[model samples]
Target chain A: MFDFPEFFSFPLGDWINITVDWLTLEWAPFFDVITIAIREPLVSLEHFLWWLPWWAVIVILAAVAWRFAGRRIALFTVCGMLFIGVMGLWDETMTTLAIIVTSVAVSVLVGIPLGILAAKSDRVEAVARPFLDGMQTMPSFVYLIPAVFFFGLGKVPAVVATFIYAVPPCIRLTNLGIRQVSSEVVEAGKAFGSTGLQLLFKIQLPLARPTIMAGVNQTIMMALAMVVIASMIGASGLGLEVLRGIQRLDVGQGFLAGISIVIVAILIDRVSQALGRTRETGLRRGG
Target chain B: MRKVLLALLVGIISISIVLSGCGEAEPEEKPLIKIAELNWGSARFQCEMAKIIIEEGYGYPVELVPGITIPMLQGLRTGDVDVYVEGWLQNQQEAVDTAMEAGDIVMLGFINNDNWQCGFVVPTYVIEGDTERGIEPMVPNLTSVFDLDQPECKELFANPENPSKGLILNGPPGWECEIVTLEQVTTYGLDDHYDVMNTGSSEGLFASLQGAYDKGEPWLGYLWGPTWIAGALDLTLLEEPAYDEEVWNEDHGCAWPSVDLFIAAHKDFPDKAPDVAEMFEKWKLDTPTLNEALAYMLAIEGEPVDVAIWFLKEREEIWTQFVPADVAEKVKAAIAEM
Candidate 1:
């Protein structure tokens, strides 16, 4: 008797019953287990990353780079970070900062170690490669649907969608970084009789830092893109103000909010790019 | 490598076994009933009214979720919303049918009929036929939608914004009016006489109407009742052909029939909250009353919540039957607080 489209007519009367239950019953608990054990502490570090005063953030970023990379790279980092705040987009820039920092933190916690394992074992890399491609290639909106289905709407789903969208780059980079860590370095470590875990920490990862940071810069850009899209699923931020303006035909308000987003994007883009450049220069100086 | 491969295989197998063992158990509490609130003047007010009665009056907490046209229907079919007030029959028939077929929603009775309508509207100037020359004079002979199809009349609306393209400001792109009006324009052969402009937001259309009226310029647009646009503008509906079922098919509901803005509850709603459902059953607001209430909210009070509460208070005698007298007293107290 039911004449509805079969797509909507599943035995689960409530779509959320099947979709949300499937997610919460299976995925949420698993994520909770992993996140509590590893991801939580890493997320806490993101707070420290944002807590630096506006000027100090720039100074500290440049200072760290100067000590590691060189003076030219440090100068670029300082100018980029300062430009973002001076554009009057400081608050929005920080919010975008907090989201990206938190997402990348969780992604790194999940991705880097997986990358290490994938690099070490051909079977692991084979299994991971397809999953990474799916994550990267899937439309960002699809990421939000499952997120809302699983977590309902709000900050949590926003972050979840953002994290899923941001993660692939870090994973791919981590794998490449570890694999590209000079066979000669591995040979040298083995010559010193370095154990597998010790050699990974002291040689492989340390040498791979610059490349991994480049991956992180890409992850931040992806996360920034997701922030605007997440407003559709009820994420509140500058993006919501922009959506609100569009809904009301407040052109001035929408334009201002759009400019705010652009300024934040440019700020983060420059700062992260500078950091990546500096990290490369640091490896050059050390080598 | 072999050992690691074996471990990973074992891990997958173990996870499957564990997952199979851990099947879903229905939650102990009844799910929070989600109510979809569409963004329109009367619909928002009506949803808020229902929320007031359900959550505050009856003491059953309901969550109000905001959604727009297609999304609201999708939400109901998905069971994201257990109740939705103001389901317009003319615009929402296909979605309603689809949801019914899926067993995703149960229809509640019409909240109030004889209120909703849509059509070409024209300023009183057009009806009076006040002509200096180029356009036809007011009051000489215009009475129907067809009369506006005159070339001279079309020339009067010649300005782009004037909708003189025989403009009817349609709802969103995919709305029922968008389809029906397009078909009607073709069927009636007024494509050259008029244009149907799809407004991005209802508010924007109302603002344009208000702007036109203030300037004393002749303005006509597509509109419906129990809407803020109706409350805000003084334009009159241009008469249409009768609502003969044969004339308007599934694809077209001829000339905007007066649809009943309805409140649909979950089938289980009466069982769970009999008192709240009773209030919804009795609650009714017709065109004149809704227009007044909308005017109060958007014009005089400038606060929708305040106007809604005021309406509830003014109509307390009518509502007291569904709610206990003491509870109604509490509702009055709540309104006073607002």
Candidate 2:
């Protein structure tokens, strides 16, 4: 009774491996297609980003920053980009920016639809909640190697790992936002004989926009964190720089790269967070 | 005459635009041949050497794919990586044997079998007491691994998290050295007093040692030479019972066996690039030769390419022997131009 059956064993890992092995065999072509789908845009975007004259990019980013994030943030963005340039990490910074943008974009596209569906249906939320929990809790390292097996170890796996790690907050936050919409307002919409689709598109979505924007911010943060860990699988960027610094025991190099990552993270965070409030503040211009 | 001159100038400018394409020098193919790079310095430096020789002497573009031990070994088996400049034979013996048996990868040549050792090591400052740093020897009487079991020594190096047991920094997880170090501690019956910490990765181990070294702290750990760390820092390798194959196989009670280092290739590599493969077969490096390069890299903080260039520039007699006269001349010409 105390020992609780010494012979009893679970084959959880073995089953997972078997499943992965089967998937690799049966889904090689499918995985390759998905890999290309992720890789093509990422590569082109990276090339385009790096190809732009450095000052041109800095100017564009600063302008965008000014539009939503205010003059202070705009100034900060310029200073950060200049620091990155001065440190001779301009090309690597562009590559990292491309990765982050692509991954966050992917997460948003998939997450919002799922979140809306979950908001409409309690059953879907119940089903997705455990997976979202798992995704958030699962160490990014755990899936990194498997991601390589599926995506063949490069930027594709890095993107896949990053999106998986980052997508959960996007989804859960969206769900919360939609659910938090005032029921009285929803009833008012129903009283006007508005169809369900009309209510969702016009009222519910508009009400949830700020919250969804928060979700996007969270996703970007998570993506940034996972991108650093994804360096182990050959994702070159500031992450690789940091890793090289560690491998060589070069403290200054590691700190420099870590500082660069922090700078990028702060820049992305402040800009996105500010962008979220722009509409509420009546500073949104293009809208 | 003015109209003619203007037309000529315009023609010249148009021709230059057609030729220049904004100075995009027609992309010289970026590394179709993938060479696996593991974490350590000597292996990386050797691969850099091979990459240069292959690119210059053999005219094939090569790239170093950053990978860890097991994954890169797996990559070699699956035909994902084309070459391994320095594959550890002793560390992953079983895995390498299995891969070779399956014909997934083949040993192209020996890389580093120069009777190097890996075991418990301490900074020389720990033993000698660095006068410059105003540090006294923590365990002046301690000399061998056996001395670590003493009460004072154990208390001195006690684990910060669990102070009941002392700490010994082992190699990274999944590393053969980590397993052996763990086993050796148990074999010596020192497990009751000491705990082995497997630093998560090679960088983790290196960083931990660095952190300790910077503070002039006492660190007992597993480390290997022919690395920049070994070259840059003065460390003392603790004594163990001389390596006995029977004892090591039975209980890992003895020191690490100096096994042959090997250069391996994907099974299909010979067919894909036969000349490069032949050149690889001739490519050899000793620990001292690689250590010199690692030291240079440490001093200058140079890239692998820079070190390789240094080697080509300085050690012409060494590399010139590995290739044909024509190939050597070609490489020399390339180096001269570079």
Candidate 3:
């Protein structure tokens, strides 16, 4: 079908598979430790999510949504949570929420610093750009096998899958945010005999906060997207229900799970975006 | 100052990473058979059954490695997984053929017995109206696969998406059944009458069928027996000319031969663990019995271990034959203890 001969094709898939087997052969115990490390946080997060009373969770979410996104979204949150409970998908929804929260938290923790570093150095950005692009674009299926191979098929691999897919935008956006911080502000800080640390914390990061928060929002969305694929492999929750609906041809079931996901996404999105908006307005008033 | 702060943060992150790598003890000294625990009711049930027998009776450890089909098949090929308890012959033929022809994997005993059916299936209500449900028959005269070519068939499934042709869904892409089904569609001269729609996976097919079944709408697509769907739904296999292997190899014009799924393993499995291999060779599950077991599995929220325990407790006559009398006694004792 091609105009050119296919002889020069790179066996990237074969190489990746071979590397996975090789890594497994050499570092099985190391990967096992990592598997446990991943499992511990995931389990704790799930427990914490489950520990909160359903009513308390709803009230807290509504309060947060109202404070940030306004009364309309707050009402939406209450209705959405009620629908999830009514559909008997409370446990599944909570599990999914826990996974998303954990992955998003981890991505931000790792991403922002690397982003700061990339923002500082052109060489680092040059190196990380391709890898970040690859992370974002490379189909999760390509890494899914290795993730399962390393973590042994469950929530751990699911977390790892999300971390890879979702972290890139976090890092990239943080880098962009910091770089876009005005040089005039940096010069003013320096001229005032401010130290590098003080300048970065006081001037750069504050200005970059909105952008970083936007990155966090993107990471959350990506994590939600990746969770569905991960569940198809092993991790369970709303995604598993969706997969069940797909496998069983239960349109009603699929729609139910899908609607639940959309509700969760919208709640998180509106609140987070508003968080950034509020801080920016506050900064303007303070300045 | 910034450099010091960055260095501190880096050090803290590194320490945390190292500290979080906690203890997960490995037991590689006592080598265990790894069973590929595929994510399906019947397959998982079989794996759990085998694990119990191999561990309790044979005194060898066994572990279930959870994964989907393709990776697990690769695991079998590479000996990462030592035992795979279910291999559908036609469905996975395209994937397994290369390894099989090369003798990288070994097929042992028939797991499903010689009892399985597969073809274009439609709900009984699609042909005959459910008077109680107040639904009229949509395609009552549709008996054989070729009857789909009837002009009335298009009127039955007319949708905004496709105005000219009715849709008869096919199997997931890359499945051998999809290939055979498409050939049958062309051969029966129904290609013009119906658009061959590919539902991305088995889930896709089930979803479409389920959506139609719930609404009492017509559906015609490839499906197999001994599944939860087959057990739960009232489906009738559209009539086909009896199976002719010669005709099938040529153009898939005839019916599918009764499928027998075999327990397969890495080629070295037989030589390394002859007893386990032999046990696999003698394994068999009656069709109706397995279907009931599948139903019970779904009833209990799709936990195959619970199904395995129940299967052993109930179907003593079937599993007892898989192992030797002494090993069977051991399994019995373990079961009794549980």
Model no. 2, DockQ: 0.02
What's the candidate order when arranged by decreasing lDDT?
2, 3, 1
Of the candidates numbered 1 and 2, which has the greater DockQ value?
Answer: 2
| TM-score, model 3 to reference | 0.53
lDDT, candidate 3, A1-287, per-residue tens:
75777887888966976776677556767977877776777777887778999998999999999998899999999999999999999999998998898788889999999999999999999999999999999988777766655654457778888999999989999999999999998999999999989988999999999999999999999998876787744566888778656543457998899999999999999999999899999999999
TM-score of each: 0.48, 0.54, 0.53
The residue-by-residue lDDT of candidate 3 on B1-338, one tens digit each, is 99999999999999887777544333433457899998767788889988888888887789999986766788899899988877777667666787788888988877764555788888888888889888788788989887877789777765223457877777654456767889898998888887765554555466556645654666777887677778778888889999999998898899888786878899988877789889999988877787889889867655788888888998898899888999999999998876
Please give the distance, in angstroms, between residue A125's alpha carbon in candidate 3 and its true position after superposition.
34
> DockQ scores for all the models shown?
0.01, 0.02, 0.02
Best by the TM-score measure: 2
Interface RMSD list for the candidates: 17.7, 16.4, 16.2
Model 1 Cα shift for residue A240 (angstroms): 21
Which CAPRI category fits model 1?
incorrect
What candidate 3 keeps of the native contacts, as a fraction, is: 0.00
Number of colliding residue pairs in each model = 13, 0, 5
On residues B1-338, what C-alpha lDDT tens digit does candidate 1 reach at each position? 99999999999999998888677443343446677888887888877777776655555667888877557767676667777788886677776776678777677667677865677777665666345434444444667777777876676665332333645555443456656777877776777777665443454355445544533456666776777767765567877777777777653535666776777765566676666666767766777878888888867645556777888888766556656787787777777766
Name the Cα RMSD for model 2: 22.9
For every candidate in turn, the CA RMSD to the true structure comes to 22.5, 22.9, 21.9
